[model samples]
Target: MPNFKLTISDIKGKSVSKELKDSDANPLLGLQLGNETDASIVGLSGKLKLTGGSDKSGVPMRNDVHGSARKKILLSKGVGLQDAETGQRKRKLMRGNTVSEEIYQVNCKFNGELPVEAPAEETTEEKAEEKKE
Candidate 1:
């Protein structure tokens, strides 16, 4: 059997080169970049596992608590969480209560032939058979 190794890099030119040895039982290796950057794999084959890794601060990755109202309140304000049943307006911790937005759009141009159209649907009338002679 042949051995497999790979080198993956991000758009910022920062790269991580890894060599897979038969002795290295762990088939998966993880690399974490900053929040603003993304890792992209190019020109390699075997199996690919691109995952978000540990934080740069050396702390373990945290699971998303999207449904927790307390977590949402804490994130929205720098103060402690509020009573869930109180129904009180939060004091905007930060200067502004605005949220920053980032948008990504991809546009590509291809000169290849158009894709083949799918076969037309057949109605019940079209499928009805003529009376045999």
Candidate 2:
């Protein structure tokens, strides 16, 4: 029973965030990075590829890792390591590619057109009030 924050991105570089409760998130469990799933589970009509995610402790997932557990690996340049100098390597903590209950945020890439949500229309009364000002 894990709640997850889904960050869905499109080809245009735009992203949308959606929330998934325990029930809705069940289908996403055990999924690893680079795996594709049906977006219909999230109320979308395209396929979504698992890019990456972070655990509750803010540990980022790395594709090279095999399981859902967290590990401290020697990373020179990758998902969990940042600002590495030339030929620099350090032991950093990172989560595995698999999605687990401890994962808080899930990153996904959409494969098709992302529907744009229209903004709410202003009521006649509200428009009249705005014109009066």
Candidate 3:
């Protein structure tokens, strides 16, 4: 499939955007943050700032308070293990070592109601104007 930027938005119409470089396979080449040898933070999620006024009084809303997880792939290149058969030199590869999941919480509303859909109907004066037109 095509790789496109993700623009996460909230109920108040505030949003945060993120773009990923085009890749042949996965498209979204996961960002290998921090030290590679230490651990691989794969699918960690976070929040972003919004542009409009605060959703809750003076408190601003966070756009992308998402959740994610991480996994351990192969061992570091230099952190080599003994060669089982060759006995010369080699590095052992380990599959999934450990996976970590994380969720970012933020203050925001996700109701499915729009501003135009106000519960109170238009006044009689407004309706009269419409009828006259």
Candidate 4:
């Protein structure tokens, strides 16, 4: 019953957002950072690697942290800490690497091309009806 908002990034630096709910998001449960999963569940043609994610409260997940709980760790330069001065460190609350129900946004890297859906062709009946008008 986990709901996840996925941020999928490709090699070209373009990013796409997708939302998965209930059973569609179950496959991502318990996955950790850097772990790869099949992207077909999300309609992508390649592999999708877990990069990072944030909980419902906006706390980020750090790769070095294990388990699925949140912790206050001393971070100088990493996923949670940004724009720090030289030799500066701070204890920031960040989530663990594992994906859990609390996680709201999941960041992923896609290894293949996105599928392009073809347009539906009009049937002869529809074409004939249009011609009559």
Candidate 5:
């Protein structure tokens, strides 16, 4: 089975991840952007929602999330994440000493893997040997 990894990040620097096979994720992800060279094979279905955190009552907060028909998600690239905008205005309410907090605004992206690195030099080892009593 082909495995695809997805990384989700918020503006506040919080992140969540999910692993799904091509068959499972393909359905949730759209493919309208397949024709574009800049875009990847998977497109945002526009149904993805980010969580804003929760209230004192443990209720999940809600806010306005931005989306477009043209945005695409590159699963195995640099940032892996794409365009994401949190609502300018959060759902604010004030009453009974309960202070409303801003919800978490997040964007989803994907990760490829660690970049290849060259072998380390041994200059440090030589210097340490010279310094030994």
Candidate 6:
């Protein structure tokens, strides 16, 4: 059950989209191909810009959120399936769904966050030069 087309871009770009189908085995939907995630526009608040889906051996689990600003996410269905006619392929029961469950289509976006760097404060002349060594 893979048919997701979720897009949410906020940071001034203002964007919103949603479509989902679940089978419940969530491996981040095998996130692949030009992947980027930090989704959370379902109700709007913070976090938008992401991607991930297609891992029934259909390949495309290219995870690359090299930058994280995840504002909470949780989806399921993508660990194993494909053998409706001896197509052979199984091994995904971390929770359930698999007797014939192969439907994936995820398109995502929720642009924002992941660029944090603020932790450098030592100005007492370097703390008295480390207490004069």
Q: All models: lDDT? A: 0.28, 0.93, 0.28, 0.92, 0.32, 0.40
Worst 10 residues of 1 by lDDT: 98-107
Residue pairs clashing in model 3 are: none
lDDT of 2 at 43: 94
Full ranking by lDDT? 2, 4, 6, 5, 3, 1
lDDT of 3 by residue, 1-111 (tens): 323233335457754444423342132223121112111111213322212212112222122212122222233232223333443444332211111111111112222
lDDT of 4 by residue, 1-133 (tens): 8999999988878788999999999999999999999998898777999999899999999999999999999988978888889999999998999999999999999996555558899999999999999
Q: In angstroms, give how far residue 57 of model 2 lies from its true place.
A: 2.0
- Model 3 ranges off by over 4 Å: 23-133
Judged by whole-model lDDT over C-alpha atoms, candidate 1 comes out at: 0.28
Best by lDDT: 2
Point out where model 1 deviates above 4 Å. Answer: 1-42, 65-133
What global local distance difference test value does model 5 have?
0.32
- How big is the positional error of residue 130 in model 5, measured in Å on the Cα after superposition? 44
Q: Which residue segments of model 4 deviate by more than 4 Å?
A: 115-133
Model 2 ranges with Cα > 4 A deviation: 127-133
Q: TM-score of every model? A: 0.18, 0.91, 0.18, 0.84, 0.24, 0.23
Tens digits of lDDT, candidate 2, 31-84: 999999999988999899999999988999999999999898998997878799
Ten contiguous residues minimizing lDDT sum, candidate 5? 30-39
For model 3, how big is the CA root-mean-square deviation?
18.6
Alpha carbon deviation, residue 22, candidate 6 (Å): 26
Candidate 3 has a TM-score of 0.18
Q: Ten residues in a row with the worst lDDT in model 3?
A: 33-42
